[model samples]
Target: MMKEQKDNLFILVKSLSKSEKRQFKLYVGRLGVNEDSKFLMLFNILDKLSVYDESVILKKGIVKKQQLSNLKAHLYKQILISLRLNPSHKNIRIQIREQLDFATILYHKGLYKQSLKILDKAKTLAITNEEKNIAYEIVELEKVIESQYITRSLSTRADELIAQAKDLSLQNVLASKLSNLSLELYGLFLKTGYVKNDTEHKRVTQYFYDRLPEYDLHKMGFREKLWLYKAHLWYSFLTLDFIACYKYASKWVALFYENKDMIILNPVFFLKGNHYLLEALFYLRHYKKFKETLFNLEEITKEKWFPLDDNNESLAFLYINNNKFNLHFIEGDFKQGLPLIDNVLKQLEKYKNRIDEHHVMVFYYKIASMYFGAGENEKCIVFLEKIINNKSLQMRADLLSFSRILNLVAHYEAGLDYNLDVLIKSTYKFLIKMEDLYDVQKEFIKFLRGLGDIYPQEVKAAFIELHKKLKQFEHDPYQSRAFLYLDIISWLESKIENKPIDVIIRNKFESQVLKTTFN
Candidate 1:
């Protein structure tokens, strides 16, 4: 019976169009097979994905709209079938029954409410108690969608769906689903502008942190296993448990050696870059002694570990964030970063004009961020303004925040305070709104502090208000919350006193806060 199914799967893959092949790969990914047949099937699936990607590129180049739509439909159906067919792989099956295919499509279409509704149903479709593990994707995706939509001014329905999803997830219908959901929620809270007092943020991280080490991170193959460890790493980070985060992250890094073949099969180098950057950033902000640890990772790889094309440029941003200029840019020689950024920009421009406006917007924002980092301030402002002016409020929220925060500092430094007060006011409103939704609160607060620093007299009242809010947070103390309070208060003090963050503050943060979580 299994042999017949394998043969049929191969045939189905071959008969499908290029788009169908890509969709099939997603489904094929769900089923587990340790034997020769599964391996062969996986190979076939990869071949199909390659073909499909080629076709997509070629079709895209030719500006073939009709053909593209046809290909997309074919691919979409394949995705649906694949998602629907993986019962033996419990997680995949639950995702299917939960209607992830439909939800994903709706999300792409900008119909977040509809997508979330399907995802909500997906949370309840699991059978065995373990099946509940898959619901987290829906829950987290819903939060992302909600944040995206709310930031834009869409109807705020994400909380309702999240509530529904969380209720089911806590019942233990599926372990992996619950774990993944908790992690996803943690990420969403961080991504959105949520405060540490945000109940959802606290609850999700606490639940997952307490349940760490139960996930056998080595069991579920590379991609899946990497994600599991990644979740634990994040949970540890949120709980201000740097030791725990680092321990899991180090274990995950070591797994790269044992399952090197699997590591080579995925584009995890980018992930490693991000992980290292996170460590470096945390250490820099906290343990200044480990600041040199940032330079440890190399610039390029001889190992073609993954099939990422020009996107490596985006990955290099991790290095950039770590301030490891030599690895990516030797003596300011940006030959590598420049070309990569250019390629990504071209892709974004092409997608913007043709494929999808929303995708174009995302790429546009990424390009703008690159430009800002590269000191192309004029170009950054142009793209940033364009995105902020986009009709979508959700879109405008991030774009506005990014543009205003960076440029606001420059303007203040230059003493170009024409209407700076109004800009700061609007910015605070946006950040506060985001904070309420459990969105990017840490970043928003950081920006608020930055504004207070650049124009102390102008933002004094607002800074005091923010300080008051931070003070109230002391009543509700999670590890992450404690860190946030300290960071914010330090920022406030620096702003009030017209001073800079000294080494002592950094040392205390590293020793008393960050190291406690990740070491």
Candidate 2:
């Protein structure tokens, strides 16, 4: 019973769209013999079901107990065939494969000339699309056909096939290596986040160089360049170098634009590249480029040619909304960003199953920041509490540390100072455990711990002292990732200048606009 609920076909069926279900039925009905067949009945039964229950199937008498697995398997195969024929699933790779399948059928029928012609066209298509693995397969089939038949360039055909196969093989191998290195580096980033100190930086730097693959830029193709840029972007992220991130992420997105079709075919990567690019811009405080990139990405997604399946749609929501928050943050328009909260939360709920925990928490952090900037200290604590109370959030130690730190600040802002000392001690111990006690965190925590000692008249002096201490680390690369979460510099300036933090940040934003105008 449990196995039935967890079956792959059941999950696939549950994930199918209404149009897919309709097409599948028409496909099954195309054969008169299948009009009332057991497998079709099983598919119909499964289609209506939210959960797969073998007992329910048994109750329907779709098939005998001994033959149930066979019927389900047959139904699964038929559904996939229907999906393959669906227009939405047709892409360059699938089109080439279909042509190859036709050629194989022709070859089996002894029509060697026809088979060779189809293979020739498919090979060109595959090569043009960077489907080199398919290109290699097509070449092998051509070679096999050529060995049995006569052709105009028989003498040079063997040489041509050998050369094409060798070239495609090398490109495929390079693409695989770069892609693997990118995946491994991504794994490391997710596991440990950015380098915390000199030791971590040295270790990650050595690890990256050790696993990095060698390839000539002049000979690299779109796929190879895409993965290569991804590898560098991950390395830049791990090193906490926003400038390098912007550089590589720009290349990543540029690679897609060079072949706009790939933006449709590889929409997930396209969305992610833009997301990372916007993040880099945000970190570097380039509000203008961030807005432009985000706007351009949204326009691209709106195009009819964009391929937006369930997965792509979920990612679109994740990336587009994330940068939307970043735009608001950089512009210091927290209240203007308010309307996005309800819509984003609703979409987050809808896409929660597709999104991972880390991303969801990242959204919460941003929303909390939005509320914090808007002077909703109580609401800010509400969002921060979600992160604070989440015991399962063990990764992203910086997130955890800052959440605790933010919680302390929010509590103080709310005049919930009765438990401030306890919260401060608890946050201090947590930071110590995470080993994230850097200059900014230490200054903030020390000030909070001694907030009781500072008289009301001397509060401005205390803020000044801590602000001066944190200013030293503003440009410190090792400690800068912290500011990416909470803009301590602007927040401190708000206190020092006796204005709301949002006002200080907004003034800075206006200054940026003025700077751009003059430039």
Candidate 3:
């Protein structure tokens, strides 16, 4: 009685598309002896089951209890082999690895000349695609073959191999260091969010510069430059420098465009670079560039050449839709963005296995913000509650903190203020516990906490005062990151102006557009 989620064989079987399952069946029956095989029967049973029940599997009598594990393992391996042989999955990396495999087999069969020939071709393909690590492997294999098979050209070939290996090793080390630094910065951002104070800012700045590897830009290849830009992008994000983020993200995306073939070989990195660029633009409030970038990305992804495998498909959905939400926020057209909410939720479910919980919560938060902008306070509260109540979300303390703060605002707006005091206290406690209670959040909580004491006639003046107080931090280096999460200035303007939040935002957007157009 194993659960479906815990059973890898069941999950794999369930993950297969219709064509894949068909291929698996054909693969099993290719010899005309495996049609009624126990593994095939087990695969069929698992494929048809909605829940993985060991008892039901045993009752089917495909195999005895003691033999079931081995059969399941064999079935899993066979299904994977079939998938590997699928034409759709045969990308450049796979093709190169297949060549390497063929070369290795030939070398083991005492066919050194043929092995060297294949390795030479693979090494060229790998180097051209910036697959330096695999290219290094090919060179090592060639070195072994050359040393054992004495030939007239062995001296020059050995020197060439040694030089190539040295160059590739240096590039690989540089890329690895930069990628490691980028990942570490990203992890830090997820765990605790942007630098909260001067102390934190200095710490992050020091950490970034200390670990950043030294490399000559002119001598660097596409892969090294890509990782270099990625490292800088993450550092900029953690430091809340939107301008720097945009600069590096632009460089990252440009690198791909300059080497178009690399885009096909490294679609994931290409997608991420564009996504980060869009994010930086969104934060900088560069409306025109953001729209253009989003449009370009959407068009590229729609192209037939763009990889649409499950992983890339999920990422495209996540990045594109996440930015679509931002686009509505930018335009203050939350009502129009409402349609995207249902579509995104459905896709989220479809790609649930590929999308992580952190990203799902991010989508939820964006949806909640959209509802808030549209003045659907109750619906906003409903979505915010999802993030606030999620106990397992260990990342993005910033998101969780703001979710609670936004929840309080939505609850107050929805006239659920009977428990306002309780909600405010709990939110305050939560922020304090996360050590994320900055000036913006503190001022917000204090204003909400004092709302009960203000007379109805004085509420407008209170709103004005709060707006004035919070406006100072709108440009503050350390505190402005809070505004990125929740646009409190616009919300307060909506209150003071006695208009809908979306109206305030729309007016602001129009002014910015006109300013950009004129300037």
- lDDT values of the candidates? 0.50, 0.87, 0.92
Q: Which TM-score value belongs to model 1?
A: 0.43
The segments of candidate 2 whose C-alpha lies over 4 angstroms from its true place after superposition are: 1-11, 31-77, 105-112, 150-155, 388-394, 452-458
Candidate 2 structure quality by residue, lDDT tens digits, 1-519: 443346778878877899999988778777665567888788778888877788888999767899998888888898899999999899887999999999999999999999999999999998888888999999999999999997567879999999999999999998998889899988888777788799999998998889888889999999999999999999999998889999999999999988987886678889999998998998888877888999998998888889888889999999999999988898989989999999999999777557888889889888999999988889888888888888776557777788888888888877999989999999999888877787788888988999999899999888888888888887888877778788888888888898998888889899989998899
Q: Which ranges of candidate 3 are over 4 A from the true structure?
A: 1-6, 64-66
Best by TM-score: 3
In the range 1-519, model 3's lDDT, one tens digit per residue, is: 843355888878878899999888877778475567888888889988987789899999889999999998998999999999888889989999999999999999999989989999999999999999999999999888999888758779789989999999999999999999999999999988989888998999999999999999999999999999999999999988999999999999999999999888899999999999999999999999999999999999999988878889899999999999999999999899999999999999788778999999999999999999998999999999998888876869889999999999999889999999999999999888888898999999999999999999999999999999999998899888888889999999888889999999999999999999999
Model 3's alpha-carbon lDDT is 0.92
| Model 1 segments more than 4 A misplaced | 1-179, 190-195, 198-201, 206-225, 237-244, 269-300, 304-387, 390-403, 435-519
> How big is the RMSD of model 1?
17.9
Question: Count of backbone clashes for each model?
Answer: 31, 0, 0
lDDT of 3 at 183: 94
The worst-scoring run of ten residues by lDDT in candidate 1 lies at 325-334
